[model samples]
Target: RVFEAMLLVGISFSPLAGDLVTLVAPQVAKAASLVFLLGAGALFLWEINAAGRWVWPTTIGLGLDIVVGTMALLATAGMDGGIASLLLINLAAGGVLLSLPKAFFFAGIAVGLQYLEHLLSLAWFGTAERSLSEVSLFAVGYLAVTGLSQLLRQEVSQRQQLVEQRESDVESLSQLNDLIIRRMKSGVLVIDAQGRIQRINEAAWSLLGNPSPTRKDLTEISPELWRRMQQWRSSGRGDYTPTALVERGTEVVPRFVAVPQSPHHSAIVFLEDSSLLTRQAEQLTLSSLGRLSASIAHEVRNPLAAISHAAQLLAESDSVAAADLRLLEIIRGQCLRMNAIVENILQLSRREQSKPELVNLRRWVVEFVDEFRTVQPLGGDELRALAPETAINVVFDADQLQQVVWNLAKNALRYGRLPEAPARISVVARRLPETGQAVLEVLDRGPGIAEKLRPHVFDPFFTTNEFGTGLGLYIARQLCEANQATLELVSVAGGGACFRIAFNAQPETLRGDKLPEP
Candidate 1:
C-alpha cells in the first residue's frame, strides 16, 4: 500500500508546471500521507505474526518514502517545495527502520542530496550572486543536519549499551534467585496473573511427589493446587495459611502456603515437607550415634569366649591328633576374629585427628585385600574391582580411605547372604567426566532395607540386627568427610542395597562444567 501511494505521488509531482499556479501539491501530498498512515496500521497486525522478522516491511516503507521525497525534490527544482523538511522526515524514518549505523548513513545521504540540489539550483537559476546571507543560510542548514544526525547516532549507541547491560544483569539475577530457592529449606513457587505455575523449587517437587503436570493449563495439572489458587484469589488475601493436601489414593499429607501479589495479579505458593525432612534428619543423627559392638556384646561375646576356651583345651591335649588340632586352631582363630571386632568398635569411638594426603584408592584397596588374604581365607564370596589401567589421584587420608572401603565391604558381606541363591557382591569404580570426580559403588543382593530404616541406616546405634554395634557406618561417614568425600546408602530395587562414595578428583568452579551434556 505504501509503495503504491509513493509511486503515484512521485509520478504526479514529476512536472514543475503545477507550482506556477499553486503554492502546494496539496491533494497529492495528502493522498501520500494517508496511505502511509493506513499502511502503518495494517503492518502492525502483520508484524505480530512475523515477530522479529518485521524489519523487512519497515525497510521497504522507508525506502518508498525516500523515493517519493527524491521525486518531489526534482519536481520542485525551479522553486522551493519545502522539501528540505521532508528530508528530515526521511532521516527519522530511516533511523527507526534500519538501526543506528544504517540510520546515520541514510541521514548523511539525505543531507547531501538536499545540499547538492540547493547548490545546483543556485548555479542553474543565477541565485549564487543573490545574497551572502542566503549562501550562509544554506551552509548553516547543512551543518545543522549533519550535527543532528551525529548526535542521534551517539544517543542510539549509548542506549544500545544500556540495554545490553540490563539484559546481562537480569540473567545473572535470575540464576542467583534460582540457586537461592533450590538451596532454601522452604519450597517456593511463582505463578503468573493467570494462576499458572511459573516457577518451582526442589522442595516443592518432593512435596508434590514430583508432579509431572504439563504446562498447558493450571486446572488440569494439579486440581487441588488450582482450587487453592482460586480460593486465594477470591478471598483477596495477602497471604494464606498452610493447608493440608491429602495425596490421591494415599495417606501422605502435604502442607502448602499461598501468597497472592503481583502488578498483573499473580499468586505465589510455598510447600513444606515438614514430616519427611524431620524424620530423615532424626534418623541420620541417631544412626551416627549408634555403636555396632554395643548392640552385639551381650548376645555374642559370652558364646564366643566359651568356643575360644574349648579350642585352647583341645589344642593342649596330647590325645588330640595333629589333624584334629587343626580344627581347634580354626575355632580359636574364629573366636579371635570376633574379639577383634570389639576392638574395631573402640577405635571407631575414639576421635582421631584426620591426616589428609593424596591417596591412590586403586593401590590402597588392592594392598589391603592382598595383606588380608595372607592371614585369612576369603572364598568365592570375595569380590574384586576392575581398577582403572591409569592412576587417578584424589586428596584423602590414606588410613581413613582403607577403613572406609573395608567397613563397606565387610558390611555388605555380612548381610548380603542368600539361602537358595549364591551370595554375590560387586565393587566397581569409575571416573566422572563432568565434575572430574571418582565414584566407588558397592552392591549386594539380600533383603532390601525397610522404608522406615532407609533414612536412618547410616546413623550410629541404629541397627536392624540384635548383634550390630551401628558404629561401623557412623565411623565410615566421619572418615568420608575427613577424606573430602560423601558416602550415601542408596536403596536398590528388587533386593539389597548400594553404598556409593563420591570424591572430588579435580578442582572445578562452574556448575555447568560439572554437568555432562546429553
Candidate 2:
C-alpha cells in the first residue's frame, strides 16, 4: 500500500516540477489529474480491504498507471523524465508482489502504451522533436526489473522452506528422546500404521521375554497384545486383561490408547504387570470416606478422649507433688498432639461443599494471626503477619482458607527452624502487580527443601521426617484447588522456603466444588 501511494504521489507532483502549461499540455494534464484521483481512491479501498487481497485493486492501479504514462508522454512531447520514473517504480514494486507471468504481462502493456503515445504525439500534437530510442530503453528497463524480482522471490522462498524443515527435524528428535526417558519405568510400544514397531522401551522389551532383533513386528513378539490393539482400534475402548504373552513368562496387562495427532493410525501400547495395581478399582473407595472418619472416631478418638479426660482429672488432685505435675503435663501434651494428628487424618478423608465469599485479605491475615496466637502454643518461635495497606480481595471459602493457612503455619513452626535456632516465620498477604490476584505466603528462615525432594512433597504419605504423617502440604493444596487457586512452593532468594497461595478470583465465586469435611 505504501509503494502504491508513493507511485500516486510521484505521478500527481510530476507536472508541478515546471510551469504546468509550458511543461505539459493543459487538456492532457487535466485528463491525467482526473485519472490520478481515481487511482488515489483505489489505493484507499485496497488498504481498507487489506492490500494482500490483490486482484481487482492491482488491475485498477496498473491501468491508471498506463493512462497517466501515455498522457504524460504526449503532453510533454516525449520528454517527461519525471513521469517516466514514476511508471518505472510502479512496475518494479509490482513485480515483487505479482507472479512472473503477470509482471511480464503488465510490463508489456506499459511498453506498448509508451510507443503508442510517441506515435500519437507526432501525428496529432505535432509539437516538438521525439524519438523511438527513449521508448525502447524504457521497455528494456521494465523487462529487466520483472526478471530480477522473480529471482529474489524464489531465493527468499527456498530459505524459508529450509529453516522450517530444520525445525521439524529437531522437534522430531527431541520428542523421540523424551518419549524413551519418560516411559522407561512403564513399558511403551509405538506401532506405525504399517503394522511395524517404530519404538520399544526397555521395559517393553523385557516384558516380551527379551525378543531378538528379528522380532520387529508386534505380531512376532506378542500376538495377544497385537490382537488386543486391533480390538481397541475397532472398538475405541482400552480395557485391561492379564495374559502371558510368552508361555511361562511374566503375566502382563496390555492397554492401548491412540497417539494423539499422529498422521498415521499409530497407537501406544502400555504393558503393566498384573501385580502392580488395580488403581481404577480403588477410586470408588476414596469417595466413601465419611465412613472412614466415623470408624477412626470410634476406634481411636474414643480411647484418646478417655486418656485426655483421665490426665485432667489426675492433675486436679491436691496431693499430687510438683515434680509429678510435670509428668502429668507431659502426658496431657502427648494426648493433645495425638488428637491433632487424628484430626488431620479425618480432615484428609472427607469432602464437603465449598461456600466462597469475598474476603478482604489484608484484614483477614492480621485477624487470623491474632486468633492463632491465642490457640497455638508458639514456644520461642517468632511468627509475624503483614500485608499492604490496600485491601486485596479474593473469592474463597473462609473456613477452608483458615484450614489451609493453619496447616502451612504449623509445618513452618515444626520443621522450618534451623538447628539450635528459634523458628522465625512470616505470613504475608499482597496483591500481585502483574496478575492483580491476591497472594498469601508462609515463609520461614530455615534450610530449604532439597531439589530432589521437591517433586514428591505433595505426594500422599511422602515425608522426610520420620514423625510426620505427611498430609499437611497435600491437604493444603487440595483446599486451594477447590477455591480455584494454586498452592506452590515458590523459591525465595535467601535460604528459606516460601509456600505461596495465589488465588484466582471471579466476579462472584467458583460453584459446584466440594472440599473435605472436618
Candidate 3:
C-alpha cells in the first residue's frame, strides 16, 4: 500500500519519475493513478474489517497487486514500462500466505496478464514487434520468487516444530528425574557454595530431625556436620571417609560429593542411617563366616574324631587308676564339647533350603513333648505341652521347628529349674487373637536372663554357662528366621524367662480341622 501511494504521488507530481508521466497519454496515466488509489483504499478497508482473519485479506490484497501492476504496464505500453517487476511482489505474498499450488496459480495469472497487455498494445497502437522472449523471462522470474518464498517459510515452520518437541522432551525428563530423587531411599541434599541448603528430599529432611529448614545454613543445623563437610571440601580428595552426625541419640553417616559441571559451586550430600550401614557390614561378615565354616569342618572334624576315640579307649582300659579315670572323663567331656561346636558350624554352613508346610500346633506340640520327654528323661513331668483347646495351624519347616524347640527346651531345663519347683518348663502354643499370628512360647520358672545379657542372648558364641558351646540359641534363631518366624525373649508374669517364637500366619495356612472334644 505504501509503495502504491508513493507511485500515485510520483505520477501526480510528474517530477519524481523524470517527467515520464507527461510524455505518456494523459488519459492512460490518469487511469493508472485511479487504479493505484482504489487499490490502496481497498487494502486499508480490508485490514480494518479483517482484524483477526488473514486468508481472505491476503487473497484480495494479492489480486489487487496483480491488477495494479498490469494496468501500470499497459499505461506505459508493454516492455517500455518498468512496472513488470512489480508483479513479483504479489507472487511473493501469495507464496507466503498460500500453499505452493495456490502460489503457482497466482504466478500463472500474472504472466498471462503481462502477455495479454503486450498483445493489446500491439493491436491498439502500431507498436514494435511483440517480444515473446521478454514475456517468458518475466514468467521465469515470477516463479523463482514464489518458489524461494515458499521454501524459506517451510524451513521456518520445521525449525519451530523442532524447538517445541525438544522443549517437551526436556520437561518430561526433568519431571521423571525429580520423581526418582524424591522416592530414593538414600537421603540426598543439595548444598550451595555458601553452605546453605538449596534442596532436600524427605529422607534428608527426616535425618535432619524434621527442622523447618528452608534455605537454612548447614552450620545452623549441625556444627559438627558443617565442620566435617568443610574439611572434606578443602581436602580436594574424591575418596573421603564418611562422617557421623550424632544428634538426639540418632546417628547418620554423611558423605559429600561435588556436583560435576555445575556453574555454581555446589555439592550433593548423602546421609545414610547408621543401622543400615551396620546391617550391610553384618551381611559381609556372615558371608565370610559361611565360607570359613566349610574349611573348619573339613580340616578339624577328622582330628576331633580321633581324639574322641582315644579318650574312649583310655576310659575302657582296666589298668587305669581311679584318679586317671576322672582325667579321662574330663578329656571325654571336652572332646564332646568340641564336637558340638564343629557340628553347629557345619550346620550353619550347609543350611538346607526351607520347605514350609502347615502344621496343627496343638496336636504337633503334644507329640513333640512326648518325644522330648523320652530323650530328656531328667525333665520328667517338668516339660509339659500347654496349647489352646482349638487347633491353630502355622507354616514352618517341620525339621527346623523341631530343632528350634529342642534347643529352647534344653536351655529351659538346664537354667530354668527353681529349688522349690524343679520341673516347671512348659511349651505353650496359641494364636494371638489381635494380630492373628501363631505363637509358641517356652516358659521357665528359673531366674530370667539379666537385662544386660538379654541383647546378646541370640548372638553366636554368647553364653553365660562355662560348659556351653554358645551356638545352640543362635542356630535355633537362624533356623526359625529361614522358616519366616521370629524368636525373642519376653518376660513371663510372676518371674521367669519366656522365649517366644512368633510365626507369620497367612490365610492359606489356616486349617479347617478342629480338635476333637475330650
Q: For candidate 2, lDDT tens digit of each residue in 298-322?
A: 5899899999999899999998898
- Model 1: runs farther than 4 Å from truth? 1-78, 81-132, 175-187, 191-198, 201-207, 210-212, 215-260, 263-266, 279-368, 375-399, 410-457, 462-469, 480-518
Residue-wise C-alpha lDDT for candidate 3, range 285-327, written one tens digit per residue: 8769767876887799999899999989988999999989989
Between prediction 2 and prediction 3, which has the larger TM-score?
A: 3
C-alpha root-mean-square deviation, each candidate: 10.3, 17.2, 10.0
Say which candidate scores most in lDDT.
Answer: 3
Model 1 has an lDDT value of 0.62
User: CA shift at 107, candidate 1, in angstroms?
Assistant: 8.8
Model 3 off-target regions past 4 Å?
1-186, 213-217, 230-246, 260-264, 272-290, 313-330, 352-446, 473-518
lDDT of 2: 0.77
Cα misplacement distance, residue 348 of candidate 2 (Å): 4.6
Candidate 3 pairs with clashing backbones: none
Global local distance difference test of model 3: 0.78
| Residue 173 CA displacement from its true place in model 2, Å | 37
Better of 1 and 2 by lDDT: 2
Name the TM-score of candidate 1.
0.54
| Model 1 RMSD vs true structure | 10.3
Give the per-residue lDDT of model 1 (tens digit) for 163-227: 99999999999999889999876667776657667778876655555667565355655667667
